[model samples]
Target: MQDAVYGVVSNYYQNKVKGNHEVGLIAVVHTFGSDLKWNPHIHALFTEGEIDKNNKWFKKISHIPYKYLRKSWQKLLLDIIKKNFTDIRTKRLINKLYKTHNEGFYVNAERDIINIKQASKYIGRYLARPAIAEYRITN
Candidate 1:
C-alpha cells in the first residue's frame, strides 16, 4: 500500500515535473478515524519538485492533477489486487469496479497546508498520531 502511494506520486511527478524521477515524500496509512471507526486510507506529503539530472531541485510544482492520478491509482490498485487474488469472484468484482468507477479511485491529499503551522498540525494529527489518543484511554 505504501509503495503504491509512492509509485503513483513518483510517476506523476516524473512525468509532469519534466521527467524528474525523484520525488520527496512521506506517506502514512491511517486505518481508523476518530470515534474508532474502521476507515483505512493513505496520506502523503510530497515536495512540489525534486532534483533534476543537473542535481538541482526544481521546486516549480504548484498543483497536483488529481483527476489523472485517480485513474492511474485505480489501475495500479486493481492490478495489485488482481495479482494477489486470482479467484474468479475477486476478478469479477475487480472488473465491476473498473467498469463502475470511470473516473478512478478517490485519493485525497491534504489541501489545507497553506502555511508551516497548518502543515505541522497536519503532520502531528496524521503522520505521528498514535493509534489511540492518550486522552481516549481510561483506566
Candidate 2:
C-alpha cells in the first residue's frame, strides 16, 4: 500500500514534469488513526514548487485536484491488495475487500503552507507524543 502511493505520486511528477521542473517528495505511511483506530493513510510533505534537474525553481501547481488524486490512490491500493490475497471464492474476509470496491478511497492533501517554521510548530504539537495512555474501563 505504501509503495503504491510512493509509486503514483512519484510517477506523476516524474512523468508530468516538464522542461526543468522537478519536485522532491517526502512521504510518511501511517497505519492507525487518532483514537487508536485501524484507518491506514499516508502524509506527504511536498515542496510548494518544482526544482529543476539543474536545480532551478519553478512555479508550483496552482490547484491540486484532490478528487483525482484520491481516485488514483484508491485504484492503486486495490490493485496492490488484490495481488496479495486471491481467495475471494473461499475466504469470507477476502470477499469483503471487493465489497467496498465501489465505495472509493480517501486522499486528503492539505493546502500548501509557505511558512516552514510555523508548520513545524504545528506538527510538533499535533503529532502524538505517547504515554499516560491508559485505557479506562468501568465495570
Highest TM-score among the candidates is held by which one? 1
Tens-digit lDDT track of model 1 for 98-120: 89998999877546356889778
Model 1 lDDT vs. the true structure?
0.80
lDDT of each: 0.80, 0.63
Q: What ranges in model 1 sit over 4 Å off?
A: 112-114
Q: Over the stretch 62-121, how does candidate 2's per-residue lDDT look in tens digits?
A: 455776576677778767666776776534554565466544466667776668796786
Candidate 2: lDDT over CA atoms? 0.63
Local error of candidate 1 at 107, Å? 2.2
TM-score of 1: 0.84
